[model samples]
Target: MRILLVLFLLAVGCAGRDDGEGVSTQRERDSVVGASNLPGASGVRGALRAADSANARHGRLDSAGP
Candidate 1:
């Protein structure tokens, strides 16, 4: 009875643990590099470009005073 309980607990623990081996496939790595080279890729230059375009289209809003 104790052996069965121990084996059941062991199986449950092992089942809950992932090996964490499939996080970085070759296609995923290539996609990450490709996106980094894109125009709006969340870096400083891209953020500045986005802000500039937004300001150009809408003009700067006066938040401090009406």
Candidate 2:
């Protein structure tokens, strides 16, 4: 329960950005980066890749759920 609460708060807290220029800056960056055309993979794939890359140094993240 405590972990769930912490995770909920973490999600909410990360929802807002405090950069000085606001939404327009993000739009400009996205336009330049073509953010809309990203591959249709779920974030788990990215996490798996990251975990694989760090395997040599720190080992992989476990499957235990919070």
Candidate 3:
């Protein structure tokens, strides 16, 4: 029936649209990532910082050569 066809089309359209529930904005992401209480968070910025610190601690990134 046309009614069932219309309902199916509407459901398909809704399913195709993303409501952005789990996605975080840059600021919100920054706030959580910037909180140092989280140890070794997988955020890009945090991971980079952690890598830099680890390299520095191990003398791996020194210009004088490892």
The sequence of per-residue lDDT tens digits that candidate 3 reaches over residues 1-66 is 999999999998888657678877775676677665675555756666776788797785466683
Residue 39 of model 2 has an lDDT of 62
- By TM-score, how accurate is candidate 3? 0.27
Candidate order by lDDT, highest to lowest? 3, 1, 2
Instruction: Give the clash count for each candidate.
Output: 0, 0, 0
lDDT of 1 by residue, 1-66 (tens): 999999999998888656598678754555575468666445645555676688776654544457
Better of 2 and 3 by lDDT: 3
Candidate number with greatest TM-score: 3
lDDT of 2 by residue, 1-66 (tens): 999999999999989777675547643554444434466434545555575577744533454435
Clash pairs, model 1 backbone:
none
Model 2: per-residue Cα lDDT at residue 55: 74
The CA root-mean-square deviation of candidate 3, after full C-alpha superposition on the true structure, stands at 7.9
Candidate 3 residue 24 C-alpha distance from true site, Å:
27
Candidate 1 matches the true fold with a TM-score of 0.26
